[model samples]
Structure formats: structure tokens, C-alpha cells
Target: MPELPEVETTKTSLLSLLEQTVLNVEVRQSSLRWPIPDDIQKLRGQKLRKLTRRSKYILAEFEHDSMLWHLGMSGSFRLCDHYTELRKHDHLIIQFEDIELRYHDPRRFGCILWLDQNSQSKLIDTLGPEPLSEAFNAEYLFQKFKKKNVAAKVAIMDNHIVVGVGNIYATESLFNLGIHPAQPASSLSFQQIEQLVVEVKRILKQAIDLGGSTLRDYSNAMGENGYFQQTLLAYGRAGEMCVNCETTLENLKLGQRASVFCPECQPLKKVKIAPQKAIKGSKA
Candidate 1:
């Protein structure tokens, strides 16, 4: 699945090229999970403004309209020649007057939603704060987890709580902060959570710079893709030695997702004692 940084990277890479053209978008395919009305009829000849992004969505605004695309797992926007050979499973295409933009998905989990201008705020209004947004600083996250019992990783990954902290990024963020993935939200200290906030932003920024971690199949707008996978400290290095201490990297199933971490680096801390029940003085 494309995380927040990956989606934003895609928007950044193609915005410059797409903003340069005043061409119409002709839809060759529109059978996604959501309706993709004739691309040309809806977006043709309209001047495209800057590309905007929210969460994992890429928003392309037009004269009075906007287009929403979600690169669900295994989905990519590849730029191919207008006359290039169309391969199998190329479900969507945006034909520019001069060149065409193609969407290739093997799993077909992606979505293409179209909405009128300024109407999108309502659709994505309830989503959580962006990880990079000012609203997501340490103080903000701490408030959300003040007395929560949920695992800190799951809490941060919740879309309604904070956007774009996926499994990979979550694992990486926890590793960077030297915090165990299974740590309870209520047990984390304010200082530790603050470190996590900083690491989250730093990792996301670095991933965006590299275009996003590309191991299986992830590419940028021009099909360049992300290269942060190479810098992964522990994400996919299960059974391998921890780079820092040479300890074997262990893998565990957390919330049904594979989590890898260096046992030494992310030491598990025991929870503090719970409050003891008081005598029934109120009933007396």
C-alpha cells in the first residue's frame, strides 16, 4: 500500500509536468472500484492548478472540479508514450493532447473518485491530522493517548487518529526512537512520545526525498519510484543481524502485521503497577 509520503512524492513529481500542459484528459479506462466518468468530459481542456494531497490521496483540481486517486496496494501511475504498447491490466489512462498517463495495477485495489471543487473538504474532513502537520506534534499525540490502553503502534496507525503511519513507517519510526512496537500507549512517557514524534517526521521526510521505499513495486510519477528501502534499518531484515549490536533481528506478529525490530535497541519496558482497589468507603 502506498503510504502518505509515497503518495505525496507522486503528487510532487507529476505536478510540475502536468501543470505545464493545458491538454484534456481522455479516459481510456474507468472501471475502478469508484466511478471514473469519461475523464475527458469531466476534466478536458480545464486549466489544472497545483497538485494537492491529503493522506494517501492525490488531488488534481481543475477549473471548477477536482479528481481523487488512491494508489491502493500495487497501484502506480506510470508515464508511458502516447503511442506505446498498452500492456495487460492497464485499467486507467489519462490521454493528454501530446502524451498519455497510464495507471497500472495488478491487484486493482486502487480507487478513482471525482468531486467538484471545494467539495472534498467534506469527504475527507473527518480524517486525522497529517503526521507532518502542526496538529500532529508531540503534545497533540500525547493528548490523544493520555489514558488509552491500545498499543502505541496501533494508536498512531489509526487513520482517525493520525494519517500515514503505516506498518513499515510505524516499525521504522519505533525503531528510530528505540521504542518497542508493542508498548502500551498509557505506559509511554511524554519524553519518549516526543522522540517518536520527531522520528516520525524525520523518517517520512527522508522517505519522501528518496521517493518512498520501493521493494516490491513502487515508483514515482515518471516511474522512478522510491529508493528508501535500501536505508531500512530493520523493516525487512528479519532473521538478519541487528546492524548496531549484531543481535539477530526478531520478527513478531503485531496486529496481524509482520513487525521486525532489534531486541537490544528497542528494549521492552515493564508496565508500572496498577492502582489497587480501595475499601468500600462510599457504600458505608
Candidate 2:
């Protein structure tokens, strides 16, 4: 599944190519991995003025803003010239005068939702803060986690806590902060929570800069894809040695998703410890 950065990247690319242009939208296949709206054909000749994101959604707002689309798991946006060859998986094709926007999905989890955008309705309003925005920071994440006993990794991944911090990012963020994955969200001090927030933002920004993690089907617009696939430290490397420490990484299931951590680097400290001077009588 593409996270916020990937979606944002897609939106950025689409905006440059398709913004303010009238669209001849066609659903090459309406029934996808998820339900496609029955009135999908109404987008024909609609001028898309807004290329915006609500949570992980890429919304191209038409003149009325009443009709919006949601790109779900495995969905990708491609900005192509009209002459560009179409692949078998291109399910939704939107044609403009100079360019074409194609939606391709191998798993088909992407969906289109029709809604009244007046106050965000159910689709956009339910999401929490964006990680990169000012509303989201260590204090916000810390406050949200104080009431919960869930693992810190799982809590951050919860869209209810903060949208777009997916499982892959949860692992990466915790790893960067030197926080063990098993730590309970409620048990974290303000400092640890703060550190977690900082690392989350930094890691997400870095991953986004690298065109997002490409463990699966994800690519930005212009067909430029994920570069972090080359820089991942702990993600999908269950038995690999920790990059920070020589200790082998450990894998466990948290929230039924694979969680990886370094036992030596991110040890769960039940009690604070300070090392003595290696049994020397005086400081050497």
C-alpha cells in the first residue's frame, strides 16, 4: 500500500500535468479489487481544478467538488502522453487535451467514492493529522498515546492516532529513535514520545524524498519510483544484522504485521541503568 508520501508524490505529479484541465474520464474496468461507484461516468468532461490529499487519498476535485476518488492499496497514478502505450492493469484512464492520467492497480484495492466535500463528510473528516503538518508533532502523538496500552509501533500506525503512518514507517520510525517495538504506547515518557515524533517526521521526509519505500507496487508520478528500497535498514530484513549494531535483527508480529527490531540497540529498559567505570578504582 502506498503511504502519504507516495500519495502526495502522485498528487504533485498529477497536479502538474492535469490541473485545471477538463477530463474525459473513463473506467476501463469498473469492478476493481474494491467497489467502483456506479456514477463513475459522470466525470466525463469535468474540469479538475484541485489535486488534493485527504489522508492517503488522492482527490481530483471537479468543478462541483461533489465527486471525489480514493486510490486504495496497490493503486498508482501515471501521467502519460495520449500516445503512451497502455498496459493490461490500467483500470482507469483519464484523458486530457495534452496528456493522460492512468490508474493502474495489480491488487485492485483502490476505490472511487462520491461525496459532498462541504465539510469533508465521512471520507476525509475521519482521518487524523498529517505527519508533516504543524498540527502533528511529538506532543500530539504523545498525547494520543497516553490513553492507550497498545504497542508504540502499532499506535503510530493507527490512522486514528495520526493518518499515513503505515506499518513500514512505524517500524522505521521506532528503529531510528532507538525505541524497542514492544514498548507500550501508554508507558512512554514525554521525552521518548517526543523523540518518536521527531524521528517519524525525519524518517518519513527522508523516505518521501527517496520516492517512498518500494517493498511492493509503489511509484511516484512521471514513473519515477521509490529509492528507499536501496536504503532500508530493518524493513523486510528479518534475520539481517542491525546496521547500527552487529546484533542480528529480531522479527515478531505486532498487530498481525511483521515487526523487526534490534535487541541490543533498542532494548526494553524496565529500569534505568548507568554503567560503572568497568570495576576500576578511579577513572582511568
Candidate 3:
């Protein structure tokens, strides 16, 4: 699925649409994860005013309403010349006076929905802070982790704890921090939590700069592939030698997602709580 960085790249490339009036819209296939809203055609004469991203969803603000777009497991958008030939799996098309935007998805898990100007989406309203935002500081994570007994990887991947730390980025971030993915979330110390915050922000920013990691079916609005996959230290390197230490990286399943880590670098500490002594004057 397209994560934050991938979504951000697409949003950035579509920035030129701002102040441009929508000329037409065609829904080749409305059977996506959800049906493309019939009212989407109402955008025909509205001007695109702003474009933003929340988690993996792109918010395109129009003069009247807005649209929420999600590029599912294999969905992408491309910019093309006016009347360019539509490709297979091209589910939706939005045209401007001089150009067109096409949405392609092989799996059809993506969504295109309309939003009222003053409405809030339940999808985004309850999401935690963006991983790179100031609100996602160490203190915030520390408090959230306190109540989570799940694995560190699972906790960080939770949308309520932090947004956009998907399986790929979460695995990579845990590996880079020398923290085992299966480590209990509440067991992480303040120092480790602090480092995790920094590492997640750094990795996410770096991925965005590199155009995101394209394992499969991911590309920018221009159809250019991401280069970050070439720089991965972990995530897909199961049974490969660790770059930090020569130990072979191992893959473990956590919450049904593969987590790759080096045993030598990220050791899962087993805390043993000592048994309490019996009371001195208690009856036998």
C-alpha cells in the first residue's frame, strides 16, 4: 500500500492543480474499496484551492467541497496531456482545461470520496499525530506506550499511537534504533522511546526525500519509481547479514507482519521479577 511518503509525493506533484478549475470527471469503475461518490461530478466548475495529506490519504480542497483519495495496495495517479488514451485499470479521471489526472488501481482497494467543506472525516479525525509532526514528540509516544502491552512494532504501527508508520517504515525504524520489534511496548525505557521518535521522523523524512520505497506498484504522479528501496537496511533482507554486525538478520512475525532484525544488535531483554519474601509473623 502507498504510505505517507508515497502519498506526499503524489500530492506534491499535483500542486499545480491549485487554482485550476475542474473541467470534467469520468468514473470508469466505481467499484473500488468504496463506490466513487456520484456527487463527485459536482466538482466540474469548482477550483482546487489546497492540497494536503493526512496519513496516507490525500485531501484535495476545492472551492466548495473536497475529495479524499487513498492509493490502496496498488493504486496510483498519473498526470497526462488532455485526452490521453486511458490505460487498463484506470478507474477514475479528472480533467482540467489543459491536462488530466488519472487514477489507476489493479486491486481496486483504493477509495475516492467527496467531503463537505465543513465536515470532518472519521477516518482522519481520530488519527494520532503525523510521525514527522511536532505533536509526535517523545513525551507523546512515551505516554501512549504506557498503556499498550503489545509489541513495540505493533504499537507504533497503530493509527491511534502514530500515523504513517506502516509495516515497512516501522520495521526499518525499529531496526535502525537497535530495538527488537517484538519488545514489549511498555517495557521500552524513556531513552529508547526518545530515540525511537527521532529515528522514525528521520527515516520517514529520508524516505520522502528519496521518493519513498517502491517494493511494487508504487510511483509518483509522473509515473517515476521511488529509489528508497535501493537504500533499505532491513525490512526485506530476511536471512541477510546485518550491516552493523555480521550476524544474520532474522525474520519474526509480529501481528502477522514480517519483522526483520539482527539478533546481535537488537537483543530482547527478559526482565525477571524476583519473588517476594513471606511475611515474618504470619501464621503457618
Best by TM-score: 3
Rank candidates, TM-score, best first.
3, 1, 2
Q: Provide the clashing-pair count of each candidate structure.
A: 2, 1, 0
| Per-residue lDDT of candidate 3, residues 218-249 (tens digit) | 88988888888888898899999999988999
Candidate with the larger TM-score of 1 and 3: 3
Question: Which regions in candidate 1 have their CA more than 4 angstroms from the true location?
Answer: 17-29, 38-40, 116-123, 272-284
Report the error of model 2 at residue 189, Å: 0.6
lDDT of each: 0.80, 0.78, 0.89
Q: What are the models' TM-scores?
A: 0.89, 0.88, 0.93
Q: Can you write out model 1's per-residue Cα lDDT over 1-284, one digit (the tens) per residue?
A: 78988898888877654554445454455766665665446666666675888888888876767778888888888777777898777877666656677778777788777765444675577689989889998888888888777778888888888888888899998987888888888788899889988998899999888888888888887878688888898898999998888989998887788889889998888888588787887553
Which ranking of candidates, highest lDDT first? Answer: 3, 1, 2
**Model 2 segments more than 4 A misplaced:** 18-20, 117-119, 270-284
How many angstroms is residue 240 displaced in model 1 relative to the true structure, after the best TM-score fit? 0.7
Q: In angstroms, how far off is 126's CA in candidate 1?
A: 1.8
Write down the RMSD of candidate 3 (Cα, Å): 4.2
| TM-score of candidate 2 versus the correct structure, residues matched by position | 0.88
